[model samples]
Target chain A: MFIQLVVSGLLLGCIYSLISMGLSLIWGVMGIVNFAHGAFVMLAMYAAYYGDQLLRIDPLLFTPVAILLLFFLGVLVYQIIIQYVVDGPYVSRLLATFGLGFFLINMAQFLWSPNFRTIKESMVHGVWKIGSVMIELPKLASSLGSILVAALVFLFIRKTRTGQAIQAISADKMGAALMGINLKRIAAFSFGLGIACAGAAGSLLATFYYIFPDVASLFGLIALVAVALGGFGSVEGAFLGALILGLVETLGGYYVDPNWKYALMFLIYLGIVLIRPQGLLGRGKV
Target chain B: MMELVRHRRFPTFILLFGLFIALVFPWVVRDRFAQNTAIFVLMYGLMAQAWNIMGGYTGLISVGQVAYFGIGAYTSAFLYTHFGINPWIALLIGGLITALFGVIAGYPVSKLRGRYFSIATIAMAEVMRISFSNWEYVGAARGIQLPIEKESLLTFQFHSSRLPYYYIILFLFIVVNLVVYVLERSRTGFYFRAIRDNEEAAAGLGINRSFYKLLSIGISAFFTALAGSFLTQFSLYVEPDYVFASSISITVAMVAVLGGIGSLGGPILGALVLIPLSEYTRAWLGKQGQGLDLMLYGALIIVFCILEPKGLMGLWKRISTKKRTSP
Candidate 1:
């Protein structure tokens, strides 16, 4: 029983890590804590669900297309909404993203209605048993996908020139500008990449979890906590944070009441805020 | 003399006139729909005022005031149902309990700066909500239903009549506004603004940044919880979802932002504009289930913040300033 829970928890953590990476990237590169991240994730889930149900397209096959769509969305959001508020007051920036989120949520409701949807048929199906513990196949594949993508992202950041440039910009915006880095391009790219990751996570989760307009609220919030837990802007920290949180949530649910699990997670977050405001692995930003 | 009369005396006159309208509302408006709408407006107004203190003045931008709100709701419901306590007294205890939670929550959360602080607030509210939904003793996913035998002042039961709720909430609204009005000019308010503008500088000036922030947070939580308590009485049912939902927090925050975050009368203006408009829109378009109003308001926030971040009061000031400057 414990082994099964641990495996499930780890799988849950894998999805969380992928989802949170996008948000952390946005924050790290652009100093923006995007409130609409959950909403954007909601959009991606719909895309996958429709891709499957409406077009008879396998969600696994349509992942790249969805990711590309989300990338453009991120860029568009940056160009139209985010740019206007980049230099504005704190409240304006917050309202802008929150407004976008609210708009998207309502727009989805206006169009699709508030019904729970799932990708009924997928390329990945069923579960694999390892002795006494049972592991769901789709979740296992999804976690493997998460690991591969997370590794790719890590390598891209550490190895590539564009990635290095992004790091430079995150470290010092003025210095990067002085080095002739185009701020707009980098900002747009970072935003695009961040949202693309959100798309990817949505595609993976749609195979298993129920999708709805408000579905992003739960995962998005959890991703946010992961970002804070690992410290903002640290991908590896986010990974670790997500795993710990997922594990804690599952174990805590079993040990203490299931209802109090999330509350306990939040109290842990508060504890972190009090004890290590800088985060376990974060920099000076917090 | 003309300027003083227009600026100062006009406001006082408007306040007196508005008070008169509030007192005469139940009698003047015989329509049940309008009465319920007015009560909702006043309740949201009180909530906006509560949010304004920590958010507007202290620049905390909390999105978790719902934690206190839910706590207040549950406290009052539990006290009245289980312990057989009067809701009037429960009202006070509810506020106190919520405020106490605020202080405990704020101590560390206040240490966080910018988006982190705001995010923490969201996390706290989410945690509370999830916990509320899971706990069996507190009704779990199924909420608590208030069992009132008959219409009584002791239990705060107002079945079939909206007048009692209207008056109670009106009094609560006035008190909250009065508190904010005084707080805006107080030394603590000064510290709050100083911390908002610059924490390091505020600390340099010997202001206890976290202390003052917690004070405002506590006060804000106290009154916001009062509004929640009133909601429990007026609705006569308490649920985790209704009370602890993030949308409730967003609505209250938007009200303060729309009215003019730092201004004294901003919350009242926000509530007056938002609730009536929302009611009218609900009547015209459809139910909130359609989410049309949300889209409209969401777009409004985006456009308004882009164009006039200072909100309605700020816009009014700008127009008046331009008029005064023109010739």
Candidate 2:
């Protein structure tokens, strides 16, 4: 039972890591917490659901399509709204994205009717039992896919030139500009890429989780906590932080009470943040 | 003479005029919808004013103020339901308890800076919400519902009319505003601004940073709890979700921000504008469950944030300055 719980927790954590990594990327590069991130995730879920229902496309195949769609949406959001407030005070940035989030959520409700949806005939289904442990196929597939995507993202940031350019910009904006990097272009790309990660995760989530306009609030908030837990702006930290949250949530739910899992996560987050405001692997003053 | 009249006498005249209008508003309006809107304005205005002290003046940027609000609601509900205590007294105890919780929460939380502080506040509220949802003592997710009593000042319920509720909230709003008005010019107020503007500089000048922050949050919590207690008595219900939801905190923050954070009359102005608009929109267009009102509200917030970060007060300042410099 413990092993099954651990395995499921790990699987859940991997998906959470995927979600937080997107948030972390945006925060690391732009110093803005995108409040609309969850809204963006909601969009991806709908996209996957509709793509399956309308076009007969499987969610697995639609993952890349969702990513592409969100990438453009991210870039458009930057050009239209975020860029204007990028240089403003923290309050303005926070309110701008918060408002965007509010707008997106309500607009979604208006258009989509606030109904809970699911991909009924997805490619992944059933369960596999491995030596007294049962693992759901969809969960296993999504986790593996998340791991692969995370690895790709890690490599993209570390090895590629554009990725290194993103690094330079995050490290020192003026320095990166002086180094002849196109600051505007890179920033927009980074924003798009960050949201694209949400797209991937959202599609994966739609397979097993119920989809609704407000579902963004659930995953979005949890992702925010995971990012903070790992230390803001640190991709690796967010990954680990999400894993810890997943394990704690599952184990806490099993051991204590399922209702108390979210509370436990929040308490752990508060304790860690109070003791080390910079997070588990973050640096400098909070 | 003209400058003095414009700067000082005009404001005093406006104040007296506004006061007279407010005093006679319920009697003159006589519409239940309008009265409800007025009550909401006053209630939100008071709560936002409380938020302004910690978030606007002190620059703590908490998004979990609903924690204090929920605490106040539950405290008053518990006292009234279980002990058969007068709600007026319960209001006081709720305020005191919520203030204590604020200080306790602030001790560790106030150490963090900027976004970290904001997220921690969120976590703090989330913990409260989740815990309250599961704890059977407080009725768990079902929440505690206040039994309806005879309408009176002591009971804090106004069954016959919404007038008493309006007057009570109005008085609370005025008192809170006056407190903020005095706090704005006081020595502690200066410390709050200094810490907000530059904590390092404030510390350099020998100011105890965390103490003032804690004080601000404590005072803010007290007043916020009063509003919460008022809500319980007014609505005759206390639920974990409604009271502890992050939306309450956001709305309160929006009120302060929209009206002009750190300003005396800003929250009142924000509430005056926002509450009526929201109520009217919800009444008119929200019947179909389409969130048109919220969508517009969100768009307005984005536009305001992008175009005028300092909010309506900033716009007022710009207009006044432009007029002064035009000649």
Candidate 3:
């Protein structure tokens, strides 16, 4: 039973890591915390669901398509809404993204009727059992998929010229501009990539979890906490934070009254915020 | 702080005019709906102002205020049923208790800067929501329902007209604004703004960061809790979801922002515009269109952020100055 819990918990952590990676990446690159991060998650879920039911495209097949669409959406949002307000008040970016999230949630409710949609069966269906332990195949696949993508993203940001340019801008905006990096182009691309990361996670999770307009808020809160835990803009830190948080929540829920698991996670979060506002592995001047 | 309206002579006249309107409103407006709307305006206005103290002045945009709101309401409900305390008196107790909670939350939360603080606030609210929903002692997810008793001032109950509730809330609204007015002029208010503008510079100047931040959150929590307590009494019920929802916190912040953050009359103007718009839209489209009101709010917040992030006060200043120069 314990092994099962640990395995499932780790899988849960993998998904959270992917989601937090997107949010943290955007903030790290552009200094804009996209409050609409969750909305994109919800959008991906809906797209995957519709793709399966209407077009008979399996989520595994639809993931790339949804990701591409979300990327365009991200770039579009940047051009139309975010570009105008990036240099405005501190609250402007927050409010703009918040408004976009709010609009998307409401739009989902209006169009989908606030109904919870579940994909009963998918390409990655059924479970694999070894002796007394049973592992769900879809969950395992999702975890593996997320880990693979996260690894690729890590490599992309570390090993590529574009990634170095993105890092240059994040390190010093004016210095990067002086070094001949296109700040706007890099920022927009990074935003798109960040959104695509979230959409990918959502597409994977939709294969197993219930889909609703409010689902993103739940995952979004967790992602935000993970981001904070790992340091605001530290993608790797967020990933580690998400993993630790997932384990604590799952193991703690099994041991300590189950219902109080979230409270326990929050207590730990508060402790972290109080003790090290810079996060566990982050080196920022908070 | 610079005195409401464009000139120095307007404050007293505006005060008198506002007072006269409030005094004569009940008599002139016999419709219950109108009175109810006015009461909401005052209540929400008070909440927005409370939020402004920390968010606008101190520059702490906490997205977790609804937790304190829920706690205040639940405290009153628990005390009333278990200890036989009047809900009226429970309001003060609830506010005090919630303020204590604010001190606890503010300590760690104040350590965070910028977006980290906001995320922490949201996390704190989620924790509160989950805890309340699962705790059976407070009736859990079913919530607490205060049975309507005999009409009496002691119980904060009156059935003849909406006048009693209106006046009580109105009184609180005025008191809160007066407190803010005083705070804005005091040394503490100066520190709050200084910390907001530059934390290290303020610290170098000897303004205590965590202390003033706590003070702001404490005052903000007190009024928010008081409002929540009154809401429980007025509605005869207390529910975790209703009081602890994120939307309430966001709405309170949005109201302050729309009116003009850190300004004296900002919340009042914001509540006046938003509450009515919300009430009318919800009344019309909540049932027919489903989530249309929320969509409107979302679009408006975005537009306001892009066009006039400083809110109505900013718009007013531009127009007034433009007229002065053009003429």
Among the numbered candidates, top TM-score falls to 2
Question: Where is model 3 chain A poorest over a 10-residue stretch in terms of lDDT?
Answer: A87-96
| Model 2 CAPRI quality | medium
lDDT of each residue in B265-325, candidate 1, tens digit only: 7778888887888777767666756878777777777876677667677776667667776
Which ranges in model 1 have alpha carbons more than 4 Å from their true place? A1-3, A131-133, A154-165, B1-14, B25-29, B152-155, B287-289
How would you encode candidate 3's per-residue C-alpha lDDT over A1-286 as one tens digit per residue? 8888888889989998998999998888888888888889899999999999999998877888988988898888888888787887777678788888888888888889788999979888888998777899998988888898788888999899999998888788899999999988888899888999999998988899899998878777778788889887677799889997888788889998788887788778778878899888778677
Cα error of candidate 2 at position B112, Å: 1.1
Model 2, A185-235: lDDT tens digits are 998999999999999999888888899998887787888889888898788
Better of 1 and 2 by lDDT: 2
Q: How many backbone clashes does candidate 1 have?
A: 0
lDDT measured at residue B291 in model 3 versus the true structure, 0 to 100: 72
For each candidate in the order shown, give its overall lDDT on alpha carbons: 0.84, 0.87, 0.85
DockQ (C-alpha based) per candidate is 0.62, 0.77, 0.69
Per-candidate TM-score, chain A: 0.95, 0.97, 0.95
Off by over 4 Å in 3: A131-133, A159-161, B1-12, B324-327
Please tell me which model should have the higher lDDT, number 1 or number 3.
Answer: 3
Report the C-alpha lDDT of model 2 over B1-327, residue by residue, as the tens digit.
Answer: 666335321244555677788889999999999999888888899999999999889999987889999999999999999999899999999999999999998999999888888888878898999888888998999999998877888788879999899888889888997898789879999999999999999999999998999999999999999999999998999888888987788788888888888777678778888778878887887876787878877888888788877777777766766777688
Clashing pairs in 2: none
True contacts kept of each: 0.73, 0.85, 0.73
